[model samples]
Target: MTTFLTFTILGLVLGAVYAIAASGLVLTYNTSGIFNFAHGAQAMLGTFLYWQLTYGWGLPMWLSLIIVVGVVGPAMGAALHALIMKGLRDTADVTKIVVTVAILLGMLFLSQWIWHPEDARIMEMFFGAGAKVEFSGVVIRYHEIICLLAAAAIAVGLRVLFTRSRVGVVMRGAVDDPDLLRRCGHNPDRIAMLSWALGSTLAVLAGVLITPVGGGALEANALTLLVIDAFAAAMFGRLRSIPRTFAGAMVLGLAATYVAAYFPTDWTWAGNLRVSLPMIILFVVLIVLPQDRLRGAAIRTRERYRAPTVRKAVTSGAALVAGVFLLALLMDDTSITTFGLGMTFAIIALSLTVLTGYAGELNLAPLSFGAVATIVAFHFGITGTGLAARLTPWGVLLAVLVTAVVGGLVALPALRLRGLYLALATMAFGVFLSNMVLRDTTEHTLFGVTFSLFPNGTLIVPPLQVGPLDLRDGRTLLMTATVLFALIAIGLVALRNSGYGRRLAAMKDSPAASAMLGQNLVKLKFGVFMLSAAIAGLGGVLMASAGGSVAGDNFHIMASLSLVMLTVVGGIGYVSGALFGGLMSGVGFTIIIGTFNDLAAATPPMETIFKSLGHLAMVATALIGMGVGKNPSGMVHDLFESYRALRNARPVLIGGAAAQAVLYVLALTGVIGNWWFAVLTACLVMMLPVFGRMLAPTAVRETPLELVGVDEPYTPELRDRLDRELGLAPALGGDRHAVA
Candidate 1:
């Protein structure tokens, strides 16, 4: 009974912080329709600032709290809402999620960059260490009591503010109908800004309260991810209810405490389960929650791109192969290995193009699929007395098959859900795979073999054997990855042009419209999931074979989401986008950082200015990728359009090609090293599209005299109408509809 009481007191303290974080999340989402994936990140940033102010600057606790929560937090929220999230309510849900996730990652990078720590820092208690209360053999800190009361007070206070306050009604109206709120003479932007301020403030308060709960030392990502627990609580309130969210937080806290206190400490499974308890709760709640509450009104989906012709695709493929061959000739073994990694990542990104871009379903966990493949290959490809390794081809096939089955099972449950709900479900699956399967080699007899599937740490991957050929060589791996990438690219293109692709496109455009046309969305969705899993699995097998081993950490929960972000930045609608994403994210990022670092190291002053890209490249990519929301068609698409536009100036293309040829000759003659020549050639190649555009004839949108007299379509009458309706009217009549 005394143990129970002690655990109960501890649980309440934890629950109070959760309640505060969740309430803040709910508040912003309610008013903005943006389920901020970065909510926890904002809280994390606040935590760091609070710590920095108190410890680093030697400021009083009160001053630190006031500045961190008041000035820093609100300013951060206001900047996000005003700069990133304003006018995004009607945008595609993918864009919204991506933007928030970008911010989440950006803040993580920002916090680390600023603090720049080699180790964790301590968080001071709200009150003096000795301040506490004791009753019935149970002891609780004054800070604990304070946190509990604050949670309750906020819950009750928010309830009153929402129900009885005029400002609350306006805030509610803004998200539901910003136009309506504007009609009633309330500034919707102001309401959004105010909600963000309040929301960010609450997030900071939660961060401050929870700091001591982490038991002193702080890790930024760890602190940020702890809000995964709060996600369950927020979902309990359907993302909008204050009281229910509070209640849910308390329940989770109590349950977690009880599990830790009573579970067998000797069992590794029990300990792992304790770690995964919040994920379990989140998964269960997301699965069991009423679907309608999560699904909101239709968001304006981005327009799909026109399919590139086979001739163009073939031309591009040939160019790609030729480029890779030349690149292989020029690069060192290290470059070859890095390039192979890029190709492998590209293969995985192709899966995203198909699933999220082509199918219009947001999958937040693509890496889990790859992880599945890695595990399967490791198990099947090991040689032993009882069981010899399967043939390389057969092992790879088996790995893909296993991943497909897992993906199919996951897809079956997500048929009724879409957008954010589906994303959450996939994220849950990722978390489950990471927590329960990864690093969990033990078996429970009563529960069966699924629980015993994985190993404790690194899984040894056998060498890739094809008859007499050994593919463990670096060059061999690069060629193998290139071949596999080409095959997947060809397959993706074929699929995009198939009947399934047509149906998928229709369903993506409008599920209701597709159903009316007699399309079976269930089958379409299911088949695509399997296909995507297969491609992702193949990538994983290639990656593992190259590395010679696999570990659980390689497939973290955030894997799939990060892929989406990178691919989207490159472009998601085309196979080229996947390639761009792969190269840019993997090799391009590595190469750029390497070049800069080399230059930096060569000069003493510049060395300090350019840190190893290894530390900042991925983070920089994510930060820049936030702009992808504004470029819905993606950078690849724009590049292709520019390519087509530049085709009229064949001379420019020829000139750039001639320049590259000269550089290649120079490299061969040893006038310049192949590495430097390759770099120069790459730069020249990148400039072709831009130079083509510059040399190409300026596009004249002016109608021919014969068509100028026509009404509607591209005519003045309809153009003026569209301009007026879109609030693009000129200040003066003479300025309206003037031809550019």
Candidate 2:
């Protein structure tokens, strides 16, 4: 009983912080109708900023806290709202989601640039130096108590404010019907800004309070993991009630602590269960939540494509292939190898384009499928213990097929899930695959002997000496793998553009309408899922074959996330976008980093500028997508269209050279980076035009207000009601026009 009591107390302490985080998330979502994916990063930023002010700048802790939580935190939220959310208010949920993701990425890179946590020694200076506390035979800490008290105070305060205050009533009204509130004369944008500020402030408080307990080795990426539990809490509350959200957080905390304590290390399943508890909570909430509450009500417009002329398509394709070939021939062996890897990523991105771009499903676990494929290939190609090695090609074939089938089966749950829920589920699965499955070090034994699946081997193929050039045997094998996969991926793309693709598109645009029109949404979704998985599996096979070894690090959750980011940033739906994203990201590991290193050495200022610009670029890209009310592809497609038109026009007198002027400005501002990075960045920016087109609403003359239920024009009475509902004072005559 004493032990249980001690554990329970500890859990409560930790639970308090999680509760605060969840409340902030719920508050923001309720007001803005957006699940701020960057919330964790924002919290991390606050934590880091607090450290900078208090320790680095020699400010008092209290003063630092005030500045960070009171001023900077709220300012960041307001700026984010004004710059990104405001523009995205009328856009699709997916675009808003990607925008948040972009913000998260940008913040991550920015934090890394400003202070590389890997090299920082602030964790000990700020958090770990604290002393411990003891109560009733249980050891606790001062920081934990502080965290608990702060969280409790915030939760209680919020509860009272919402239930007992007039402002709360107005906020609730705005949440329920922003349009109706707008009619009453409140500026919804102002309300949203306030909510964002309040929520972000709370998030900062939670981060600062929790950091002392956990120690402050916080980075934007690392801290984001804590938000997973917060998300589970919000889901448990159905993202509605504040009290419920707190309760949910408490439950998760207690469950995690107790499970971790009781579970024996001897049992492998125990470890898996312990790590998987939050995801289990998430999955359960997602599965049990009412469909109406879960399904986002965003209408997506169908893409209108103008077919490229055959001559143009042929010329473009030939030129691209020839350039790649020429680069391969002229470049060093390392560059050639890097290019091959880029091609492999391109295959993976192509798979994403098919699922996310064409089908409009946010399948974020393609890397998991790749990991599975890698394992299967390793087992077949090298392991000599079982039937796997004896039947190498057959085993490989079976692995790809089985992975595809499993991928489709996994996606079955997503057919009923949408938006954030779907994204969370996929992310959870990816985490599970990375942490539990791939990271498990246990060896499989046959006949009392443990087998190593990644045993070294070499394949030698006699190369034909063509003219004066003799390609190495390994290069030939890699090239063969690349060409085979490329062909297969291209074939799949063609298939996607056919009747089957149209069916998937129709289902994505309107499942109900598609079902009414005799389309089998279930079958279509399943087929696409399987196809995507197979393509991913094939890419994995190529990746492993290229490296000649299979390692768990190759398919980390971060890798999966990077794949998703690249796919979105490149262009979700277009084939060209996928190809572009693959090349850019894949080449980054080699060419981009190498170029940055060179530039950093040449100019000391270039290092800081490059890092800052990279971070800012990510944020700006995401914001641009949201601001334009489209995905990355929309921007890319538009640029290409513009460029094509420019190329076709007769040469005119260069009066101002507007395009050249813009390039010169970009170069002068130092945002362009190295020549290669600049070119890649430009290509990525260009592809954004076609990115979110399929997910955006149709092009209409009127705005969202006119298209929605609002019929009357804006009036003073309407404005007053809006103000009242959004927690603002009504105009003098507006209060008199209340319906009651």
Candidate 3:
């Protein structure tokens, strides 16, 4: 009884912090209509700031707490609202989710860069570590008591604010009907900003309280995920009710504590279960709880998906393969190998293209499916003699097929889910896999064969030999992946242009309208999920082969988030976008860092600058993702549209191609630096359209009245010009009433 009581009090302390954090999440989502994926990251940032102020800067604890929770937190939230979140209105759920995730990544890396992970940093507990009271043989710490009181105060405060206060009422109505709120002379945006500020303040409080309990270690990722425990609590209330959220937090905390206290650590599943408890609860809550109704016409995306013809896709793919082969000549073994690994990333990203791009389903765990495939391939394939020990056709087929089945099964529970809910469900599955399946080390026997996932923490792949061809060589693997990606790209293009593809697109546009039109939404989603899973699985095996090994950390949930972010940043709606994402993440960034390392090796004085730049890559990725709101269609689409200006300028295209080719040849021959060659070629490509427009301007096309807003932004000037053209503008000798 004493042990249970001790654990219960401890659980309540943990639950209180969770309740505080979750209340903030619920508040932001209720007012802004965006489920902030970065809520934990915000809390994490707050925790780090407190540490910096109190420990690093040697500020008073009270001063640091006030600066972080009272000022910094609210300011950060308000700034994020004005800069990023405010622009997300009317954007697709994917855009909102991705942008928040970008903030998460941005904050995570920024903290790491600032704190320098090598240093030992500890946050002292409030009132000192030993400040506690003994009650009937159970010891209660001061910090614990403070947390409990804070939670209670926050719970009551928020309840009263939302239920009794006019501001809270206006905030609640912000999402329901912003226009109506505006008609009532209330600024919905301002209300949302206030809610964000309040939410951030709560996040800071939660972060400050939870840090001491977590051994005072300020590990960024760990801290962020710790705050994520509040997600389960937030979802428990269906992202609204404070009281229910608090109840859920208590239940979650108690469940985790009880399992840890009573469950045998020696048991294989026990550790995983305890580690994954929050995610499991989150998944269960999402599944069992009734979901909100399908938002009718609520889905608004600026993205445009246009399927390429088979011929165009094939030609582009062939050119890409050729480009890869030529590019390999300029790279050394290690660089080429890194580039090859990126191809696998591209393949995985392509799967996202199918699921997110065409099918309109946001998957946060694309790499989890790949991890599943890698497991199957390692076991089912590579089992025979010396040459036969390599990957076999049957094993590859088995892996893909098995993963597809698994994907379909995964989708079964989440079929009714949409948008953010669906993304969370996928993320929960990925977390579970990361914590349990991928981390499993115990040997298991099936069909008289024994194997384990990441046995002893790593799964090494044998040299990849398919039939008679050995692709273990870096260049060979790169070329092989390129060909495979091309084939997949072409196939996806064909799928997009097919009748079934049309149905998927229609569903993406409006599931309700499609259902009304007799389209089977269930079948479409299922098929797309399976297809995507299969592709991801294939990419996994290839990635393992490319890198020669796989580990649990390689497919961590955070890595999956990055994969989705980079892919979306490249252009989620296009095949080239995946390819672009794959290269950027895999090859481009790797090469940039590699070049810097090479420079640092040759020039010692610049080592610090180069190292810092390499570290900045993470922050750069986040910044790029944050820009998705401005260009929702993606970078590839923008590039494509820009190049259309050069369509009539054959001489410009020829000149640009010649210049790039010459630079490539020079780099291959060691006459020019590979880095220089790459930069010059990119410059030439970007400048081609500019040169084309200057030298051979395209004919002006008349804009139809209906196409004004559809094709281009309808600005005041454009509108006024159109009105004048139609004799409706009073300033242009038209009737004032007609203009009005």
- Which tens-of-lDDT digit does each residue in 619-708 have in candidate 3? 887999998988888899878877866777888888888887788778878898976887787788788878887887654534555578
Model 1 TM-score (2 dp): 0.89
- Per-model CA lDDT versus the true structure: 0.78, 0.67, 0.87
Give, for candidate 3, the lowest lDDT window spanning 10 residues. Answer: 729-738
Task: Name the TM-score of candidate 2.
Answer: 0.79
TM-score of 3: 0.93
Error of 2 at 664 (Å): 23
Give me the runs in candidate 2 sitting further than 4 Å from their true place: 120-133, 172-176, 268-273, 293-319, 383-395, 444-489, 548-553, 602-632, 643-740
Cα error, candidate 3, residue 344 (Å): 0.6
Candidate number of the best lDDT: 3
Q: Write the per-residue lDDT of candidate 2 for residues 610-657, one digit (tens) a residue.
A: 655555554554444344344434545655654443332223213114
Each model's Cα RMSD = 6.2, 11.3, 5.5
lDDT of 1: 0.78
